[model samples]
Target: MTTATPAPTPAPAAAAETGVPAARRVPVARAYRFELVKLVAQWRIRLLVLACWIVPALFVIGVEQQSTLPSDTLFGRWMHATGWAGPLVVLGFAGTWALPLLTSVVAGDVFAAEDRLGTWRHLLVAVRSPRRIFAAKALAGLTVILLLVAGLACSGAAGGLVAVGGRPLVGLDGHVLAPGDAAGKVALAWVCVLAPTLALAAIGLLGSVTLGRSPTGLLLPALVALAMQLAQLLPLPVAVRLALPGYAFTAWNGLFTSPEQYGPLLIGVAVGLAWAVTATALAYLLFLRRDFTNPAHDGPGRRAVVLGVLPLAGLLAVTAAVLSPATGATGSGIEQAKVERSVATAFAHLYRMQTRQLNRPDVSEARLRATAACDKGSIRVPVRGPGNDWHCVVSWHLPGTDATGTAVYQLDITSDGRFVADGDGPKEVNGYFLVRTPTGDAPNPLWQFDGDVELLSHSKG
Candidate 1:
């Protein structure tokens, strides 16, 4: 009878017994690197990066070919004045719509794609820890987003500079910024956009974790952003508007002003961080509890959704409460004094431009001593809020004369403190739509001018 020899020790046990190390588990950094490689290899991501680099250049070229300017958008009228304005105008459009949709392309699909391909089991087996996998995927998505945004900024700046040349940029407050200064501000504006865009990405990530479907995950965040944009158009309280995610899109407006307001930017950053942290935390919890064994499982049921939403709603309510006091003082209505001051300053600047066009002696804005008195509607009520019926009478001293020149202007004001003032011209001074200059006919700055006022009051009284 032959004695059965003991089976040779298993490879892992033999390695342990021999003082040799067994294979090490994959590190989080390696998982992260793998994620980056996967993202880079995908056709969709490659196409997105290409589009970011090419689209803005084509847009700049198309705008240059057209005779009419996109005057409705901020910096649109200035596109011909300086190349720097091109990037700013493009930024306005991108912030409104493109950012949410583009960011969601990666963020929304990061997890959903694994579900779609039935690779969750394989992924979990390879990574071992769900937390590390989540971190790796999240970091990869963020890296792609940063890459796209940087590509857009650099492409836009390059295209604009090539198409229009680097002239001084005209600020919203009628101040001119040198090319160097404008470049810095443009970079900062793009940086400010990152916070809100990342918040949108977090929302996409949550949808990916909860929905378990690629299409729904992709569209959810964009639809939510669109809804918020529509809500902002309603006549809501100032505090309510400030708390909305869409408000962050317009936060860069302050950076283009004379003194550079920071209130809106600060509020935007705070709101974005609150939303991002809350959504990411919720997503992490949901991901950890997901039923990966069943590939056909279609996300959470109605009960799960309600349970998940409750905490988010409660947290947002708390955020609104904290923000209300700071924004409440401005919520009452736009003050008349603010409007008067803005109009006077804007008119003084435009009048100076008109004088320069006429080849007349230079007149200082301070010496103009411009003053405006405004009233709303046929009843002649004092202007205290936004309206299209508001009218103003502006009086200023003409150059080398004691006689005061007065002009009547019809103002159409929006709730966000932007206004278009159409002057009832003397024809000779303010001119019509276009004025004759020594070089040629040009747009009359005094005929119609845009101005913005601060919604919040800083007055001690």
Candidate 2:
């Protein structure tokens, strides 16, 4: 009876004809989920997450611990920490060691690691179409990029908040930004900073597909990055500005100030996207078409080499064409020695003019001490004022442009209540002191407060 029943089941000839089940269609969501499975297995990704939390926390602790640096005005003190020189002291060391490297670690290995484990073949087999596989990988890489960007940015802001003490953030324009506004600006600034790295991701892709090794993609992109960074400093044609990976960073800084401008940043994003698309297309074409028969004998196709080399050649060609250097520093650059003197001298002159108008006594030089000092690219000057009394504080900006660093110095003639001076209070009294840091071409009465100088005219010395 059992044998008869089994024979009857096989009588459905139509089902028997094909002798195989219908192909199971993989939904896009499932395919994407599969890609996620592959990504989670990566060791580099795990390490990146760990580093993101650990490093920034340690930095924040250190900055907060050193909170003894007296802030004359709370905002001014915070500005000191955020200013060019100050943040450079903090974030610079952190950024150089890991943050920049993380960008490569995540992006470079995402595609290349598949080849390392000989998994690309398996992936291609499951997802028959190259376009789908490529799209999945791109999406995965980009997702990781966003994670890293967000991670780094959030960690940095947290660290800065703790270190600087939560308060109104002052901008380069000297306008006080509310805590809510400052938080948003800082977050936006970090995002803006991360945008430039997209080009670096493109470079990583080219290396990933062709080299098929994590080291190749990571190291080559880093070397290329250093070269491009140095190339940016070279005197190049105005058009060349659009090509640098960091060209977008400068524009983000504008967002921190009043009158938001995005022209340069937009141009940078466009240029970065163009490079990324071209590189990704070539990477996909080579990987999909090339043979992977033997591990040792199989190599990246010739098309891969041309694709990679051409970009490198184009970069080099542009550098060679645009590089222009001066025989020596500009006149202002050479006269940097007189900066301290110029600051004091300028303050003395301005003081005389103001005092004359107010009909006050000519302040004695003996009463004058260097309270604050700074220089434009050309002339250095020291701002002098009454430190103890908080008398009239005076300052002046020399000539030329400074992209970074102290731009102007000011002296408070009368101390209302705030501002701190290290050493002898008398040392700052009737002396030149650092009142504010100068940014760009113009002088603004705002700068970050380091431990020593004070700017709040309301605060008496």
Give candidate 1 misplaced runs (Cα > 4 Å). Answer: 1-15, 18-23, 303-308, 380-382, 429-431, 459-461
Task: Quantify how close model 1 is to the true structure by its C-alpha RMSD in Å.
Answer: 3.6
After aligning candidate 1 to the native by TM-score, how far in Å is the CA of 58 from where it should be?
1.8
Single out the weakest 10-residue window by summed lDDT for candidate 2.
450-459
Instruction: List model 1 lDDT by residue over 1-461, tens digit each.
Output: 99998876458888888887866567889999999999989998999999988888779767866889887777887777688988888888888878888878989888888888899989988888899889999899989999988878888888788889888886666667889999999999988888788888888888888888748777877987888788766656667666765566777777777788678778877787777787888888888888888989767756447645676667667766777786655553466777778788878877877788779898898888999887785665655767788888889987678898888888887776677888786776554778888999887877777777666654322
| Clash number by candidate, in order | 0, 43
Off by over 4 Å in 2: 1-19, 67-99, 163-165, 297-302, 311-461
Best by TM-score: 1
Which candidate achieves the best lDDT against the true structure?
1
lDDT of 2 by residue, 1-461 (tens): 35554433333454467574444445566777777666666776877776665666565556556735334423324533442222322333333334446657766776676666777667666876666776777777777777766666666566666556556554533345676777666656655555556666767767777777637666755666666556544444424544565455444544543444354456556555656666677677766766656554233756666767787568635632442221121111112222233234334433343344344555643344423333322223322332332212233332243322222333222221112222222222222233222322211122222111111111222
Which lDDT value does model 1 have at 453? 69
